[model samples]
Target chain A: MARRSILGLFSDPDTTANAMDALRGAGYKDWELDILSGAPYPEGTFGEHMPSHHLFKFPLIGAACGLAVAILLTAGTQLAYPVVTGGKPILAIPAMAIICYEGTMLGAILFTVFGIIFESRLPRPRVGIYDKRITEGYIGIVVTSDETRVVQAEKTLKMAGAIEIKSGA
Target chain B: MHNGHNGEALAASPEEVTQDILRKHREFTPRFKALVAVLAVLFLLGVVGFIIRLQDGFEHRVKWGYYAAVVVYLLTTAQAAPMVAIAPRLAKANWRRPVSRAAEMFGVVGLFNLLLFIPLLFLLPSTEGRRTIWFDGPSMSPHIWDTLAMVFLVLCGLAMLWAGSLPDMAAARDHSSGRRQGLFAKLAMGWRGTDLQWFLIRHRIGALASLYFMFLVFTHFLIASDFVLGLVPGWKDSIFPAFQALSALQSSIATMLVTMFVLRKWCGYERYIGLEQFWALSKLLLATSLLWFYFWWSGFIIFWYGRQPVEQNVISLIISGPYLPIFFTTFILNFIIPLVLLIWNAVRRSILGPTVVGCSILVGTFFDRIRLYVSAFSIEDVTAHALTVVPPAHTPDIADILIIIGALSGAGLSYALATKVFPVVNIWEIKEYMLLRVQAAFHRMEVTILAKPE
Candidate 1:
C-alpha cells in the first residue's frame, strides 16, 4: 500500500459516487479531490453541490455585444455613406433588429463553445492518467487521503468495486 | 367482497399498464381516423389543384404570377426545412418520442417539392409539339436535362423517406383494427414483428436520416442556384444558404405544430402528443421564426443601406411599390401574426391558439415564399392603389398541373399505403421507456439512501 492516498482526479458518476461514499463513510471529508469526465455530470450527482458553471451564461453577454455591433454596423454603413435611396429613412429599425439578433446569437454560440473548452481544461499538456479501461468503459476512481488512511481507503474501494486501484507515491 | 381487481384484479404498477398499452396493443382512435381522412383530403386537394395547374403553358411568365410562384418555391422549399431538421439533433433527448415522426414528415414532404418544378419543363421545344389540351406544354427552361435531374433527385429524396418510414408504418398497421382501417392492410407488408426484420430496419433508418440531412442541404442550395443565387443585387449575400436553412427549420416546425394540433383532437393523440409536447414544438417554431426575421432584416438592411443605385431600385420596389401589400402580408403572416398570437404563454399553452398560430405561420410562410420569388423576379413600375397593383398568381398550366398533382397524389397515396408496412413510431424504443423510468427511480432511491447519516 502507498504511504499517502489522495483521490484528487477522475470523473465517472458511478465510480465517483462510490468513492465519495467510501471517503465520507471513512470520515475523511477534507480530502482534496477533482473529477474528469467526457461530459458535465451535474456535480450534485456525486452527493455534493457543484460550483455553478457560467459558460452558458456567456452566450447572453455575447448577445449584448452582438446587439451593439449590429446597431453600429447598420447605422455606421448608412452614416459613412448614407444611401439616399429615393429618400427613405436611413436607420431602418426593422432591418437593424435582424442584425442585432443574428450577431448576438452568433456571439453567444461562439462563447458557449469556448466556455465549455475553458471550463473543461481539455487538451492538457500531458496525460493525466495512464489507463485504457477508463476509455473502454471503466470509471477511474482516484482517492487521495492522508498517509495513515491511504492504505485503508484503497483496500476499502478495491473491495467495493475498483477494478484496478492506484495511489500517489 | 371484491375489494381489489380480483377477476383481473392484479395490483400491477402503472408502468406495467403503460407497457401493456404501448407494447401489445395500440388502437387508432376515431379521432386519428378523422384526422387522417382530413389530411388525406387536403393532400388530395393540393394534388387536384396541381393537376389543374398543368394545361396553361409555362412557356412564358404569366402577367405577374410567374414571379409569385417562383417566390413561393423559395419560401416553402428553400427556407423552411433546414432549421427544424437539426432540432432533434440539437436537443439530443430520447424525448423525441413525440417530435421525430413529424420531423421525418417534413423530410418526406420535401420530396414533393420537385413537383412544383414541372412548370420549368414547359419551355422545352420537345413539349411544344406534344400538345394535349390538359397535358401538353413545352418546357419552361432551355436545359431539360438539369430540370429532369432535379425532378429525379426530389423523387429519390421521397423514396428515402418511404424506406425509412417502413417500420413505423408496420407498427401503426398492427396497432389498428376492424373496418376502422382500410389503408393499413394494403400498405403493411406483413410486418409480423420478427427480431431479424427489426434489426435490419433500424440499420436502414439510421442510414437514411444521415442521407436526408446531407442530400437535402445540397437540394436546397441548388434552389438558391436555381432561383436566388443567380439574381443580382439581392443575390449578392453569401449567407443565403444559412437563410434558407433557418427558413426551412421555421416552416418545418410550424408545419409540425399544425400536424400535432390537428392530430391530438382529430386523431386522439391527446394521449400521445400532449400539451407539454405541443409547447415544445411551439417553442421551436417561435425560436426559428425569430431567427428568420433576423436573417430577413439583415439581408434587407444590407441592400437598403448599401444603395449602389441598382440595388436601390429593388429596395424601393419592395418597400413602397405595387408590391408593398404582398410584402406586408408576408411579414404579418410569417412574422407579426404568429408572433403576436404565440407570444403569450397562456395562449401558446391553449389547445387551439398554438394550432392557429402554427397554421397562420404555415400560410404566412407560403406567402413569404411568394413574396421572395415575385419580389426578386417581378417589379411593378407603376405605383397604383393596393387592389390595382398585382393579382394572385394564376393557376398552373394543364401539363404542369398534371405532373405536380400526380406527384403529390403519389405522396399521399404512398403515405397511406406505407402506413400498412411499418409502425408509425419506433416500437422497440417505446419498450425501452419503461426500463429507463425504472432505472431513474432506482437512481433516485440510491441517492436518498446514500444521503442518510449512519
Candidate 2:
C-alpha cells in the first residue's frame, strides 16, 4: 500500500528550498513532496521544468481572425452599401481601408482576451489549499520522490532549514 | 513604505504587508487632494459652459468649441507607449502585472469620453446634422454604413473596456469598501475573481488590446477626414490623420507621465512610479518630440517646395501672420523644451524636469492642434466669405475657452479618480521583480561556486 505523507508548507522561499534539501538528504530523494501554491511559477527555478501555457496560440489565431475580419468588413461594406463618388468605383480601396484596419484590430483584440483566459484555465474550482505566500512571491516545490530516499531527504531538508518535512503515503 | 519589499524573507506573512499597503492608501496627500478639488472646479466650469452652449444654440463658435473637445477625444484613442516602451525592457517586469492596468484604465477612461461625445451624436441634425469634424457630414448613402460602423466601433470599444477591466474589477471589488462600489462593480458582471473567471477575463483583455490598436488607427483617420474633407486649403493634408495619430500618441504619453508624477508625489507611491520610470519616460519624450518635429518638418517642407498658393498662403500666414506668436510657442514648447531637458541623465532621472517637460509638450501639442485646426478655420471662413477678422485681437470667447478646459478636466478627473485605487505600478510586476532578481543573483552565485578551482 502507498503511504500518505503530509509536508508542513513553509511560507518562505529559503525554508522551502531548505526543506527540499532536507527531504533529498533524508534518503527521500524520490519521496513525494507537494507545494500547494498561490501563483503559477516555474519549478525550474529550483531545478525542475516549468509547465508551458496554452496562451501561445493567442497572437497567431487572433492575427488570423483580425485579417479575415478586416478583409470581410472592407469588402462587405462596399457591397452592402455602394456609394460611387465622382465616377470612382463603389469599392474604393482607400476609403474602405479604414474598416479593414479597424476590423482586423478588433478581431485580434477579441481573440487575445479569449486566448489569455483560456490558457489560465479560469472560472473553475479555486480551493484554498497550501502556501498562500506563493501569491506574495514565494516559490513552493512539491515532488514525489521514490520511497527509498524519504528519511535522508527529510534530514537534508531539515538541515537546509525546512520548517516542516512530514512523511506520508 | 519606501523600501516596500526590502525583506529577503522569501515569502512574507501577508498580514503585515497588506496592512502596510492599506495604511499607506489611507494617507492621502494634500497635493492630490488639491488636484481633485481643481478638477471639480474645472468640471463645474465645463458643465456651465455646456449648458450655456446648449441654451445659446449652436453657432460657428460654439459648434467649433464642441469640435475642439472631439479632437481631444480623438487623441485619447492612441495613448502613447510611454510605459510599454520602457517598463518591460528596463524594469524586467512580469508579463501578467502592472502594464495591463494602465492600458485597461486608459481604455476605460477613453470610453467615458466616448460616452460624453454621445451628445455630439444627437447634435447631428439628420441631413443637416452631419458635423464636419469626423467626416463630411455622414453622406446619405454612406451615413447608414457610417452610423452602423460608428455604433460597432463604440460597442466593441466599450466591451473591450469592460473586459479589460475584469481582473482589476475583481481586485477592486474584493478590496473595495461598502461605499466604494463604483463603476467597476456595476460593470463587473459578477466577476468573482475565480480561476475560472481568469480565463474569460484574460481572453477579454487580450481581445480588447488587439482591437484597441485597430480602433486607434480608425479613430485617427476618421476624425481627420471629417474636419479636412471640406478641402480647407492647408487643412487638406492627406497626412493629417497620421500626423494627428502620432501627435495624439505623444500627448497621451505626456499625459500618462504627468499622471504618474502626480500619483507618486501626492499618493506616496514612491516605489510604484519610481525615478527609473521618470528616466525612461523622459527619454521617450525626447524621442517622441523628435518624431513630432519630423512630421511637422516633412509636412512643411513639402508645402514649401510645392509652393501651392493656397498651401503657402496658409503656411506663411501662420509663420509670419498675426498668430505667429502662438505658432512659434507651440514649436518651442513641443520640441525644444523636451529635447534639451531630456539629454541629461540627471534631468531625465529627476521627477520635476520630466513632468514639466511632459506638461509643456502636452500644451504644445494641444496648441499645435488649435493652431492647425481652429486658426485655419478662422482663415478659411475669412477667405470663403471674402472677409477678414483678426483672431488674436480678441480674447477667446468664454464658450471657446470653457470647452477646452472642460475636456481637460474630464481627463484629469478620471485620472485622479483612478489612482485612488489601483497601484499606479503593477503590484504583480514588483513581486516578479523581487523573485526573478533574487533568482538571478543566486544563479550568479552558483556560477561563481561552479567556476572556483582548488
Candidate 3:
C-alpha cells in the first residue's frame, strides 16, 4: 500500500482545531497528522500530540568532552615544559581555569547547534504536501495515510470547513 | 490596542502584519541607497587610512593606539548590540518582539570587526617580561587564545542570528521569486513550521542566546585584560574587565534604543515599534546607567584611596594628567548625563529621551576607549614595573580620525546591507505577541492581559 499526504488549509484556528478533532474521531492517530502555521503557537494548540526531545543531553555531553580535553591540554603542556612560574607548581588548576571555562562553553555551543539541526529534521529533502499560503497566515493540517484512506481524510477536512485541499503521493 | 496618538492600532491580524512588514522590507528607496553609498565611500576612506597607517609598521605602537580604541569601541557598542534582544527574550518580555531582529542584525557587523582586529594582533607586543594573566604558557598564549575567543564570539553571534531568522527566511522563501527565492530557499533549509521545528527553534535560540552572553562577557574580559591592562604596567584591577563588560551591556542597550528610534522615525515602522518598546527598554537603560556609575566608582575608589606611587601614576596617566579633559567628557557623557536624564520619568519613558542618552553614551564610550587604550598604548615600555612618567596625550591624526569614522561607518553599512536580506521587524514574533495579548476592561481603565506559554 502506497502512502499519500493530504493537506487541508484553513483560515481560522477554530476550524483547524475542529479538523484535527475530526481526524481523531475518524480513527487516524495523532502521529499521522501534523499542523503547520505561520506563527509558533504554543504546543498542543490544535490538540496535537507533543513529542519528547533529548536536546538537553547534547550540552552535558559536550561540556564533559570539553572539560576533559581542556584538562589534558593544560596539564600536558605544563608537565611537558615543567617550568616553575611565580613559584606555582606545575599542573596548576588556577592557571588552567580560564581556558577550561572557555573550552566548556565553546563545546556546548557547537554541540547545541548540531543538536538543533538534528532534532529539527532540518534540510528536509522534500517539503511534502506543504502549501505556500501556510506562511501567509493560513493553518494547514496535513494527514499521512494510505491511498485508500485519502478520500476519507479529505472528506473529514471538508466537513470541518477547509478552504483548500492539496494532495500528493 | 490603539496607540491613540497616531490613530494606529498596536495589534494587527497576522496576514496584514506579514504583508505590510514584507512589503516595506522589499522596498529599496533612494534614501536607503544614498545612505549605503555614503557609508561605502567613508569605509573606503578608512581603508586608505588603514593602508597609510600600515606604512608606519607595528614598531610604533603609539600610532596604532587610536586604531585599537576604535576597534574596542565597535566591540563594546555594535558587537554587543545582540544582547538587547537576547536578554529581553530570556526574560520573556513581550515588548521585545518588534525590535528583536534589529538587535540581532548587528551581529553581521562582527565580521567587519574581526577584519579590523587582525591588524591589532600584529601591533600587540609579545608578553615576554610583562605582567599578564598567562603566567607560564606558550609564547603565543595570549594571541592564540584571544583570536580563538574572538572567533568563537563572532561564530556564536552569527549562529544566533541565523537560527533566530529561520522562520522569517521561510516566509521570504514562500513569498519571493527569482534569485531571492533561491537564496531564501537555501537559507530556509526547507523550514515548514512543523510543531517539532518550532520547538527546536525556540530551544536553539535559548541555548544560543545563553552561549552568546557567556562568550560576550569572556571576550570582553580577554580584550580588556590583554589589550589594555596587560600593556599598561601596575594597572592590576580585577574589576576593570567586569567594568568593561558592564559598559558593553549599557552601550549595547543604548545602541538598540538609538536604532529603534531611527527605524520608527524614518523607516515607517512606527506601527510595530512604539512607545511601549521604548518605555520598556528605557527602564533597563536607567538601571545600567546607575550601574555604570557604580562600576566606575568601584574601580576608581581603589586607586584613589590607596594612593600608592604606581597607582598614582596609573591614575595620572588615565585620569588626572594630559587626558583630564577627555576623562571629564567621558564621565559626563557616560555616567552623569544618563543618570540625570533617565532618573526622570518623563525622559525615561519617552522615545527621544533614550535616543538622546544613547547618543551621549556612544560619544562618551568613544572618548572612554581613547582615554583607556590610547593612554595604555602611549606608555614607553610594556616591560616596566610602573609608569615612570605620564606620557602626554596622543591626539588623533587625520588617519586616526578616518579610521574611526570608517570603522563605525563599516558597521552601519553591514547592518544596512543585512536589512535588505532580512526583515528588520520579526514577522512571527510580532504575530505571536499579538496572539498572546488581549485588551480587557478593568473598572474604568482598559488594560492588556498577557498569556505566557509553557
- Measured against the true structure, the TM-scores of the candidates, in listed sequence, are 0.53, 0.71, 0.98
Segments in model 3 whose C-alpha atoms lie over 4 Å from true places: B4-9
Docking quality tier of model 2: incorrect
Candidate 2: regions farther than 4 A off? A1-9, A13-91, A115-169, B1-22, B26-38, B58-62, B66-78, B81-104, B121-214, B229-235, B316-322, B376-395, B439-454
lDDT of each: 0.48, 0.53, 0.88
Better of 1 and 2 by TM-score: 2
User: Where is model 2 chain B poorest over a 10-residue stretch in terms of lDDT?
Assistant: B445-454
For candidate 3, list the clashing residue pairs, or say none: none
The candidate that wins on lDDT is: 3
Assess the local accuracy of residue B248 in candidate 3 as a C-alpha lDDT between 0 and 100.
98
**Which 10 consecutive residues of model 2 chain A have the lowest summed lDDT?**
A123-132
lDDT of 2 by residue, B54-146 (tens): 776544442553345344543543243322422333333333243335544554455456545555444323333332332322344233433
- Write down the TM-score of model 3's second chain: 0.98
- The digit string of per-residue lDDT tens for model 2 on A18-74 reads 565555555453325544433323343343223345554675677678778767766
Scoring the B chain of model 2 against the true B chain gives a TM-score of 0.76
Query: In candidate 1, how many Å is residue B237 off?
Result: 3.2
Question: What TM value does model 2 have?
Answer: 0.71
